[model samples]
Target: MLFLAEKRGQGQVLPPNTGDTCSNVTMLDSRPFSVLSTSVKSEIRKALAPDILAFAKATGISREDGFDLDKVRLDALQIPVNNKKNKLYIVHWGDMLFGVNGAIWIVEVNSHKGRNLIAPDEGRNRGRSFSGWGMQTLSSENGSYPELMFASKGYYAGGGAKADAQCVRKVGAFYKINTCPAGCDDNLNSR
Candidate 1:
């Protein structure tokens, strides 16, 4: 549901995003959502197991390890303050989202494995282009955190702007977690 909306393009799907091999990446488009039978969708989801497993195997480890599925406590999945102030991660076992720069692939950010497991760096800056306490504060206020924020910066340890562009170009996913801790304060953000 989330990917579809984000992949629709613009900054999320940034320029120089793809190589010639792959076509445009799409998510949450108007088309895929509409269906006559909810049951059919359910069945399709069920049917996806084998292919998903194959994908996992084809890549290397099984999907179970890659996604960190067991760690996910859907209830406890309250987006953690990994660093950034505002954005939140829609994580399961790992950070999973679709992408396409050369060839589209379902990318996952795994804290379980160090750096080898996830996508190789796109060779951009080690940190974000935008800096300043205000940006960091806004990010925290919004519950958005960089996927692998590094500590080199004052606040954020790992996420960034190019990271976002790269992410969108790689896979049209945008951060979509409501980071406010359920009722303490909902009216803080300026977004």
Candidate 2:
């Protein structure tokens, strides 16, 4: 997707605000998802902040009293499922001062069942014991089903642990951990 950025005085510039929205924003003629807008990005952040915050709280990650909504980056990707139902993966990540915080939320549009599969990743890996997650989906070797994978390389100083897990899509709540090759860390595993 094409993204536009704004320039400021003295050659300072801001990161590309691909999530921005405004009344005058319009889509590019040839691109269905690309948008150009002058206003700040606020719509999705406002709508999803509560769920994000709650996820963090449930995982026991201590965050600052308030988060910078403008710093949040929201990404939506369509997941391929048969004709059964519609699935969209929503990922949100941002800097929360002391460290960065990131979370992935799965939204089942047709069923209206949306939930957080993992807690937000916060603080340094050394301090937190687990590095930030790398997420992707892999097809089962046996051709039974597809799996949403969350992998993390951890710090030995903290606990000498690592995590690799595959979660599958269900009807109501999706992404259940099928296998954790790294021997999951209870504190680090949110699902």
Candidate 3:
């Protein structure tokens, strides 16, 4: 995939927006994912805002219903593919006041195409102690894209808690869920 970087005024170059309709921003950094700067994350959020808004709308959530962009949480991972790399970003938001559980939008950005994976109903009963989503690289062999592990934890009613997880791998142009790990009883002693 070829990404052509566009130069703004002065010397500022925006991220490559490529073939995605969501936004025209792309990352120019060649460093590892651990060193992603704040500015890069901001650009990614801006690029993904439209898609996130659309998902929120489809889920019956609106800006008027406490769905502010400032409240959303963003997480990103860089996946190496051959000599190039693709970026995967997760945008999460919720309105517990309105009985809406947490929602997630995962967007994969590359020079060839852009794809999204959404968990419209996720993180329910995620208590105050519950952290946000987590991602791990399951496999990235022989220059091929990797399988990914996504996990989160939440509480059930009656003071019990559970952990949920899924494994996904890129198939063709999109990602497919491979397996759902058994949820753990975090509060078995409460029984």
Candidate 4:
């Protein structure tokens, strides 16, 4: 195969080595994926805007289909990971901030690697107490965000601090961004 294809100048050509059959062979496809268009990128960023309800209502997107991707909002709110790791995500109904004042829908996550709101890091924030939401920069290069403020239910059972969990749900805002920077060409073949 190497000898026949090289003669046609289809790719890199190699000379036959003495008594070596696989000398000029390698196993890997050197193709790049289609990058997302700037417009799509912008849309993705816009979709993840802390004010998703406003955009959804404004865009006439009422609800999402269980498996239909068209119903999912695309955006760029992704956690930084290895270059080969997948960045795409599916927004769950529970994972969304839905309400009029969407600001109180989230709690704050302050970690060096930042926090994935959907999947809170328990190792770092276990039993660590936070005073309150005085105020701070709600956003950064990571895009706009919502604070996942915490509060104790103030109840106990069997002397153990039995606490109930609930979001502020006041002015809470955030959009679920489901997308790929490398545009959707799932087959991954260049046209």
Instruction: Tell me each candidate's TM-score.
Output: 0.21, 0.43, 0.48, 0.17
RMSD of 2: 13.3
**Candidate 3 residues 83-153, lDDT tens each?**
44555544334334323224444555555554554322332222111123443444554145555544454
Of the candidates numbered 2 and 4, which has the greater lDDT value?
2
Ranking, lDDT, top scorer first: 3, 2, 4, 1
- Residue-wise C-alpha lDDT for candidate 2, range 84-139, written one tens digit per residue: 55434334342243132234444333343443433334222222112223444444
Can you write out model 1's per-residue Cα lDDT over 90-143, one digit (the tens) per residue? 211111321211111122223221111122343221111111111111223222
lDDT for model 2 comes to: 0.36
Q: How far off is model 1, as Cα RMSD?
A: 17.3
Error of 2 at 20 (Å): 37
Q: Cα lDDT for residue 156, model 2? A: 55
Best by lDDT: 3
* Cα displacement (Å) at residue 71, model 2: 6.6
At residue 107, candidate 1 shows an lDDT of 22
**Candidate 3, residue 121: CA error in Å?**
14
